[model samples]
Target: MEEKLIELVADVLEAEPGALSLDTEFKTDEFDWDSMKGYAILVTLEDEFGASITVDDFIAAKRVGDLLGLVSE
Candidate 1:
């Protein structure tokens, strides 16, 4: 699941899977995560994992690891 999530995120970020990790912080200097990217990720999560992620849940995800919970739940 983690590997798949990483790959999904990397695809959204236009990055390589190897470039991302659970510890990777979104909207940081390393990652130019904007509102568009956030929404993209949210939509992708719902589509890929069949998980319902709320706005609050998305906002709370500061790192890649944080998103794991949204789907796992």
Candidate 2:
């Protein structure tokens, strides 16, 4: 599950899959994540995980790990 989540985030962020860690910040300076990419991520996660995530979830998610935790719940 963690591996799949990491791949999804890395694909969306255009980063090397191996470069992403659970602690990586989605909106940090090192990553170029923007609002558009963020929404894309939300949609992708919902579709892939069969989960319904609200806009508030995206708004509150500060990192890929945050989203992972949300969907896992």
Candidate 3:
């Protein structure tokens, strides 16, 4: 899930996968991340992990690990 989420972050933010890590703050670490990117990640996460995520949940996420935690929950 970590690897897949890293790849999705890169795809949505147009970043290099190598630039991200398990602890990467997906929202703040990247200059280009926006609400739209958050939305994209929400949908992709649902598709990939079968997790039900809300806007508030996505907005509450501060890091990539938050996402992993969310889906795992």
Most accurate candidate by TM-score: 1
- Better model by lDDT: candidate 2 vs candidate 3: 2
Full-model lDDT for every candidate:
0.90, 0.83, 0.81
Cα displacement (angstroms), candidate 2, residue 62, comes to 1.5
Which pairs of residues have clashing backbones in candidate 2?
none
Candidate with more favorable, higher TM-score: 1 or 3: 1
The best-first sequence of candidates by TM-score reads 1, 2, 3
TM-score of each: 0.93, 0.88, 0.86
Better of 1 and 2 by lDDT: 1
In model 2, how many backbone clashes occur? 0
Best by lDDT: 1
Candidate 3 lDDT over 1-73, as tens digits, reads 7898889877887888998887888886444777787888888889888989877877888878888887887
Residue by residue across 1-73, what tens digits does model 1's lDDT show? 9999999999998899998999988667566768998899999999999999999988978999999999999
Better of 1 and 3 by lDDT: 1
Candidate 2's residue-wise lDDT over 22-60, tens digit each? 877877667776888888888888888987888887798
Cα displacement (angstroms), candidate 3, residue 60, comes to 1.1
Off by more than 4 A, model 2? none
